[model samples]
Target: MPNATATPPAFRYQGWSLFSLLAALVLLMTVMILIINPDLTEGVRSAIRATARSSFVLFLLAFTASAFAVLVPSPLSKSLVRERRFIGLAFAFSHLIHAVLIYWYGQLNTEFWPGRTALGNVPGTVGYVFVLLLALTSFKSTTRLIGATAWKRLHTTGMWVLAAIFAYSNFKRIPMSDWYVLPFGLICAATAIRLMGKLAQANKRQSLQRVA
Candidate 1:
C-alpha cells in the first residue's frame, strides 16, 4: 500500500501528466472523428493535395507548439534543462512534424527535396536544417556526451536558427506569413522576460555587495 501522506507520482511528473491528459484528449477526438465520418479524414487529405493551405496550417501549429514547448511555463522546460531524454524526443517530434508539413507543401508542386531551387524553396531548406540540428541535439547520448554547457550553447544557437527559419518562411509567403507573428511574438516575449529576470538578479547581487 502507498503511504497516505505521500504525494502521487503523477503530481511529481507534472509535464508528463499534462501531456498524458492532452494525448488522451487527442486520442478521444481521433476516435470520435473516425467513427462519426469514416471518410472525412481521407477526404480532407485529398483536398489538401491540391491546396497548400492545409499543410500551412499544420506547419504553423507544429511551429507554434514546439516554440511553446520552449517558451511556455511548464515542467517540460525543467525536464529539458535536466536533460530528460524523452522530453527532448517529444520536442524533436513536434519540430519534425512542423518540418514535414512545410516540406510537404514545398514538394507538393515541385521536385526540390535535395536539389533544384525556387523562390519559395530556400526557407524550406533552412527550416529542415534547423530541425535536423534540433533532432541531433535531442538524442540522449549526444546530450550526455556533450555535457550541459555545450548543450546549452548548441540549443541556444539552435533556437535562434529555428526562429530565423520560421520567420523567413512566414515572410516569404507575405500575407500568408502574417499568421506566424503570434508564435514568434510569444517566443520573443518569453525571451525578454527571462533576460530581464537575469538582469534583475545581477543588479540585486551587485547592490548586496555594495552594501556589504
Candidate 2:
C-alpha cells in the first residue's frame, strides 16, 4: 500500500498534445465567431479580434510561467513552466491566424491597407517579426543551431518586446474605448509579477551563495 503522506503527481498537459488542444480551441473559437456574424467583412473582423485576444492570453501564460513557478511554487505553476514552450507555440499559431485574417480583410476591403499609415503598422510589423523568429527557434534542432546563449538572448528579448507591444497596442486603444483599459492593466500587472519573481530568484541565489 502507498504511504498516506506521499504526494500525488501533478497533472500536466505537455508536448504536441497541449499545442494541438490549444490550436484546435483557437480555430473553433474563430470559426464560431465567423459563423455567428452573418456579414462576411464584419465576421472576418470579429474573427481577427477573437484570434488576437486568444494570442494575447497564450502569450501571457508563456511569458509569466517561469515567474509564477518561482514566485508561487505550486503544482499548477510548475506545470505551466513545463508547458511554456507549447503554449508559446500556440500563441504563435493564434497570431498566424490573426495575420491571415488581416490579409483576407485587406483583400476584401480595398482601403484596408491603404488607410493605415506606415508608422501605425510599425509596432505590429516588429511584433510579428519577433514572433516568427521566436517560433522558428522554438524547436530543439533550431535551438541547438543557435547555441544556448544566443537562444536565451533571443527568447528573452523577444518576450519583452512582445510584452511591450501588447501593452502599447492596448494602451493606444484606450482612447477608442474604455474597455481597453482592462487588458492594459492586465499586461502591467503581469509585468510586475515577472519582475518580482526575477528579484526573488536573484535574492535566493545570493543567499545560497553566501551560505555556501
Candidate 3:
C-alpha cells in the first residue's frame, strides 16, 4: 500500500524558500549597514555612542512592524500565518539583537542597560529567557517531536511570554513618543478579540445544535 501521509509542500526544501530569502536579505542588509556606517562596534565608537539607544528604539519599532505585518488581515494573511514558524524564528533573531544591545548598554552607561541595582537585571534576564526558549523550540525538529497539540500549547505560552516581554521592554524604555507603540499594543488586543470571537462563534453553533 502507498504511504497515507503526504508531506506539506511548505516543509519541503524548495529553491529560494521564503525563509532563505528573508535570511539572505537580512544578512545583506546588516553587512551593508555596517559597511556604510563603519564603527558599528559597541565600544569606543562615537557613532555607536550617538546612535545605540535610538537603534534599539528603532529595532523595537521594526520588530513590532514585522509582527503586525504577519497579523494583518488580508489575502496574504493566511499564508503569513502559515509561514509564521519561519517568520517567528526571524523575529526571535531580531529580539536576540535587541537583547544584546540592552546588555551592552548596561555595560556602557553603568545604569541604563540594566539599572544600577541587581533587580534591574531581572527584566532584561526575563526577556532573554523568553527569547532563548523561543529560539530553541523554534526548530522544526523540536516542533515535530512535540506533536501538534503539544506544540500549540507551547506556542500559546510563548505568546504570553512574548507579550509580557514586549510590555516590560517598552515600559523600561518609556518616555519616548513613538506612535507605533499604539499599533503594537493593538496587536495584543487584536489577538484577544480574535479568540473571543472564535469562542462566541463556537458557542453560537453549539446553541443552535442544542435547539435543533
Candidate 4:
C-alpha cells in the first residue's frame, strides 16, 4: 500500500487538474478580449489569431519537452518533461478557443471561410484531426486501448504531420510581410532541436547499454 503520509502528486500531473487551469486561462483571455475591443467581430478575429499563435507555440513546446529534457542537463527542461502532458492539454485548450472563434467567424460571415473543397481545408482539417486524436489518447487508459506500440506510431506520425502543417501554414504566407519569417524560423529551429535531441538521447542510451 502507498504511504498515507506522502503528499499527492502535483496537480499538473494528476488527472484533470492542469486542464482546468488551461481552460481558465483561455476563458480569461476570451473575457478580456471582449472587454477591451469596441468592435466585437474584429476582436473575435484578433482573438482567433492570438489563440492560433498560442496553440502553435504550445504545441512546439510540448512536442520538444521530453527529448529536450533528455538532451539538456538542466532543471528547467526536466520540469518541462514532467509537465509535458499539461503543456499538451494546454495546447489543446488554446486550439479549442481557436476553433470556437473560427465557428463564430463562420456564423457571422461564413463566406469568409474557404470553399468547401478539400484544397482549402487540407492542412487545417488535418491538424485538427490529429489534435483530437492526440488529446483523446493522452489519457493512460485511452492510450492502452490502442496498445503501446500502435499508440507510439500514431503519435509519432501525428506529431510530424502537425509539425509540417504548422511549417507550411506559416511559410505559405510569406507574401503578407517579412514578419512571418520569425515564426517560420522558430518552428524550423524547434523541429531541428527535437531531432537533434532525439539522436543524442538514443546515442546516450546505446552507450549506457554498452557500458552495462
Candidate 5:
C-alpha cells in the first residue's frame, strides 16, 4: 500500500511535449496573422513581429526559470526550471520562423535590406550566432562532448548576450512606439530577479559553511 505520508509526484509537463505544443502554437499564430493580412509582404512582416514577441516571451521564461524556482519555490516555478531546456528550444524554433520570414520579406521587398546599415545588423547577427550555439549544445550528447564547465560558460554567456540584444532591440524602438517600453521593462525585471536569485543562492551556501 502507498504510504499515507508519501508525497505525490509534482505535476510537470513533458519536455518535448511542451516544446511541441509551444512551437505549434507559434506556427498557428504566425499563419493566422499572415492570413488575416491581405498584403503578402505585410503579412510576412507581421508574422516576423509576432514570432519575435513569442520568442522573447519563451526566452524570458527559460532565462528566469531557475531564479523563480529558487526564490519562489512554487510548483509552477519548479516546473519551469525542469522544462527550461525545451522552453529554450521552443524559443529557438520561434526565432527560426522569424528569420525565415525576415528573409522572405527581404526578397519580396527589395528595399528592406538596403534600408538597414551594416552596424545596425551586427547585434542581430551576433545574437543568432549565440542562439545557434546554445541550441546545439543543449543536447545531452553535445553537452557531454563539450564538457560541463565549457557548456555552463557557453550557456551563461549566450543568455546574457541574448538578454542584451532583446533589451537593446526594444529600447531602440521606443522612439517609434511607446509600446516598446513594456518588453524593455520586462527584461529589466527578469534580469533583477535572476541576479537576486543568484545572490540568494550564494548567501545560502555561505550560511551552510558557517554552520559547518
Candidate 6:
C-alpha cells in the first residue's frame, strides 16, 4: 500500500498582499498626477501633501486595529490586526513618495525647503526619523535584534511622536485653510481611541492584580 500525505491549501491573498496592491495603485495614481500637470514645483508639493494625507489614513488604520478589534470584536477590525504590519509598511511607502516629492519640490524651486526653525519643519523632520525607525523595526529580524521590551518602547514612543506631529501639523495649517480641520479631527479621534485603550488596559491590569 502506498502512503498518502495531506496537501496544504494554496496561498490566499490577505492583508499584506492586499496592502502591496493598494500601495502600487496609489503610487501609479500619484505618478499620473505629475504626468497630467508637468509643473514640478507646485505639482510635486500637491502630490506630497496628498500622499501624506493618504499615509495618515494608513497609519490610523494600523494604529487602531488591535485596540478596536478587542473593543468591538469584529471581523474587519481583526483583519486589520493581521494586516497591521502591512498597513504600516504601506504607510511608509506612501510617505516615501511624499518625501521624494518634497525633495523634487526643493530641487525645482531652491527655496522650497523651509528653514528648520519654521513651524512645521522641525517636527516634520523628526516625524520622518521616527517613520524610518518604525519601518526598520517592522520586520521580525529587527524586532528580535532590538529585544521585545525595547521594541515596545521604541514603537510606543514613535507612535506618539508621529501622532503629535500629525496633530500639530494639521492644526497649524488651519489658519491657512479650513480644510485642515478634517485631518486634524481624524488624528484627534484616533488619539482619543488610543488613550481610551490605554486606560482600559491599565484598569484590566489592576483588576487582575486584585484577583491574584
Cα lDDT tens digits, model 6, 34-87, are: 778767666777788889888888889877777786567666676777778888
**Per-candidate clash tally:** 0, 0, 1, 0, 0, 0
- Put down candidate 1 lDDT per residue, 14-127, tens digits, no spaces: 455534543344344434534565565443333332123322332333334333434453554433334333343444444444444445545554543445547556665665
lDDT of 5 at 157: 97
lDDT of 4: 0.82
lDDT of 2 by residue, 1-212 (tens): 88986434364457798999999999999989988998999999999988989999999999999899899988788888878899999999999999999999999899999999999999999999999999999999999999999999999999999999999999999999999999999999999999999999999999999999
> TM-score for each prediction?
0.51, 0.95, 0.59, 0.88, 0.95, 0.87
User: Which sections of candidate 1 miss by over 4 Å?
Assistant: 1-88, 99-119, 171-174, 177-181, 201-212
- lDDT by residue for model 4 (104-167), tens: 9778766767546768787999899999999999888998899999989988898898889889
Cα deviation of 52, candidate 1, in Å: 13
Q: List the residue pairs that clash in candidate 3.
A: 106-113
TM-score winner, 3 or 5: 5
Q: Of models 1 and 4, which has the larger lDDT?
A: 4
Q: Give me the runs in candidate 4 sitting further than 4 Å from their true place.
A: 1-15, 114-117
Q: How many steric overlaps does candidate 1 have? A: 0
Provide the clash count, candidate 4. Answer: 0
Per-residue lDDT of model 5, residues 166-205, tens digit only: 9999999999999999999999999999999999999999
In candidate 6, the residue pairs with backbone N, CA or C atoms under 3 Å apart (3 or more residues apart, or in different chains) clash, namely none
